[model samples]
Target: MPIDPERARLLFQVISSCYERRSLILTTNIEFSKWGTILGDEKLAAATIDRIVHHGRLVEFGGESKRMGDSLMLGRQ
Candidate 1:
């Protein structure tokens, strides 16, 4: 897949600006090490990563449950 680096940079800028003084949440199945490759642009990816890491906290979220029903069962465990 082709990557438009300029658009990535602009989008990153927009996200950073929006997050500067407000709350934001992002959920991603893709892990951090794969981001630069997914981005397909080294510079823009680096910049984006820098912005995100600066503005966000990383936590270890545990295993996935398939459904709300499963979650309820797990809660009782």
Candidate 2:
């Protein structure tokens, strides 16, 4: 799903204001390269990513989703 332009702008504003001033923890399944598609603007995505990665540590998980497993268990019950 594409983000609304207004919301994307707001997100950029938030990130800009918080850049190097506050810590932000973002979790996303989508890779940085594809953020433009999700944000609906390449520039906005790039700026956001630049700020995020500049002073951030990336932790990646590589396994089946725990949420998916929980959902399957619920369905079985």
Candidate 3:
């Protein structure tokens, strides 16, 4: 689902305010390219991403989801 416009604006404000002044750690399963659709604004998404990646370190993990391993229906088939 796309983010609400007002909330997206608020999020941008928060990120902008924190940019270069504070450290932030954001975790998302969504890819950077889809941020425009998620935020519902391409410009906002681009600005957000630009600030984040400018001083950010990306750490990617590979393997099955931990949630699936602990799911109740894992072996129900």
Candidate 2, residue 64: CA error in Å?
2.0
lDDT of 2 by residue, 1-77 (tens): 88899999998999889999998888888999999999999999999999999988999998977787778667931
RMSD of each: 5.3, 2.1, 1.8
Instruction: Candidate 3: list runs displaced more than 4 Å.
Output: none
Q: Write the per-residue lDDT of candidate 1 for residues 7-76, one digit (tens) a residue.
A: 6667677767866677667777787677777777767667777777787888767766467546765683
Report the backbone clash tally of model 2. 0
Whose lDDT is higher: candidate 2's or candidate 3's?
3
TM-score (C-alpha, index-matched) for candidate 2: 0.85
Q: For candidate 2, what is the lDDT?
A: 0.90
Task: Look at candidate 2 and tell me the lDDT of residue 69.
Answer: 70
Q: Could you tally the backbone clashes for each prediction?
A: 0, 0, 0
Looking at model 1, residue 21 earns an lDDT score of: 78
